[model samples]
Target: MLEGHQLLGFGFFVIGLWHLFNHTKLHALGSKSYTSTLWFPTTISRYMELHFIMASCTIFIAMELFIAPIHHQPFDPDGTIPTTHLHNFEHSSMAMSFLVYAIFAIVLDMKCTMAQHELTHFLGAIAFTQQFLLIHLHSRDHVGPEGQYHLLLQLLITVSLATTLMGIGFPKSFLVCFVRSVSIVFQGVWLMIMGFLLWTPGFQPKGCFMHLEETEEYVVKCSDDEALHRAVSLVNILFSFLVIGVTVFAMSFYLVMLRRYGGKVEYVSLVKEEHYREEDGFVKPKGTIDLENNMDDDESQKKSMQE
Candidate 1:
């Protein structure tokens, strides 16, 4: 039952979660060298992560442009666009923006040319902004539980856009990166939730059902208020679990890296600090303390002889 959109979301989820560790460090076996970019074992592993995002965008483009269109006519014969067609068009445009971002990002990584990190962030912001606008516009057709879900998704998209824009403004802020990654992961998870809850039958909102008319396909409405409330409550619980689970997993990965790589880094740094201090005469070098003691005894013997 996994359709293109759901699969796309899962892909984005994995990729977004991967970005959560963009700053992780890993210890090299039997070496003091520590690094976080070991996914591809390349110096450009960070760029690889960005490239994966780009690839995900491409998949979205493919689904919207090539696959989804085949199932439904994008435009009526008279050239008027239906709501569904408009939604598809909006989705494709957003994916295009992401594709543009990925290209610019690769350029920035490889050549250090036009549109640096800030520009990349700007591109990401624009892409998510498109999604936010589209979701808001498309949500007009939906009401009740489905509408509420769309509203929540739009809020997330807005947060994602804000995070990217903030990243552009505060390029050096680690918090911005953290929030951005979380937002992206949340988007993916929400997409999957929407697919299972709204698209699938068994997990449909309580007392709510889907109508499959071609023009009205993928719409869910509630017949009983109580059942709908219960379903919504269940959704909230599941969503909370998802948030906690993903957060915990990300933190676990970070802690593992810290133990393996960060600890060694600290040890190496301490050794270097001591060596520098000794060189600067602030701290005596190893074995130099014994030599100094011997020198003091010799000086006392000479003083006694002089006496």
Candidate 2:
């Protein structure tokens, strides 16, 4: 769960930064209302999305390969899977999926031109889809507030997937981008809540108790109806917090964009010819020539001939 939270929190944070830098223009920020477009101002800026994803995936891979091995044995020496390693294996698999997408995105960025952004969007959706499935499949056995939290997280992951798909179809839609960013932010916040509430000493659900054996991590189980109610209320409060956090981040980002690029002209690709220059080429050449120069040249030629 901690790994899940950290992965999602950092991934979305990077993505939020990418969207702020790449997909947005300061001109719209300064306006009372602005629409978003899919293109970025510069070629390098256009690849920020992939860079963030790749970086996040690298971190996940590192965590899985180095950090995780220290804590959990993912497989038995005989090559049989253990019940204890199920969670670890699931997380590792999810990380691998992100790594795959990141590598694919980087390759596309370097070698491919058409549908690169669209493909990235699809890949992102696939990554989220993997998480969504894991949460659904794994949480079925969880019975208490922990289960509820996983269910909520699954919903957010679903939204993340949906928004990514929508982004692929309507890459220019500002609303889609905004929703996607907010969804991710919400996921991160919820992950933090889960980490604190489920694992921390003080924040466990009111009606539930955690049991830990010598060989296993703690598992939460509900003890009474009243505790369940308290846990549900706590979840409700956490959701309210998520909403507030997203609102604050969005507003702050808007203000920052407005202040930065508000007055500048829209940035264009340096490689492409300007529209005005193309239009200039269509103008007809003048019919009036340098008749005086032509006459003088003619007279000089005739004088030479006579001489």
Who wins the TM-score comparison?
Answer: 1
Q: Each model's TM-score, in the order given?
A: 0.72, 0.71
Instruction: Give the alpha carbon lDDT tens digit for every residue of 152-256 in model 1.
Output: 778778877887777765655555666666767788888887877777887786587877657655667677778778766766776778778868876786677
Residue-level lDDT for 27 in candidate 1: 26
How big is the positional error of residue 115 in model 2, measured in Å on the Cα after superposition?
2.5
**Candidate 2's residue-wise lDDT over 1-307, tens digit each?**
4675667566766556556554445336543354443223346675566566667766765665456664444667787865665666676667667777877877777787697888877777788899888878872266567777887888888887898888877755766777776677677767766876787666676667777745476776667877877776777777778778778887787668756766657766743544565677854358856567799999999999999
What TM-score does structure 1 among the candidates reach?
0.72
TM-score of 2: 0.71
**Model 1: runs farther than 4 Å from truth?**
26-51, 69-73, 265-307
* Cα lDDT, all candidates: 0.67, 0.69
Where in model 2 is the C-alpha error above 4 Å?
1-4, 26-52, 58-72, 213-215, 264-307
RMSD in angstroms, all models? 7.9, 14.6
Backbone clashes under 3 angstroms, per model: 0, 1
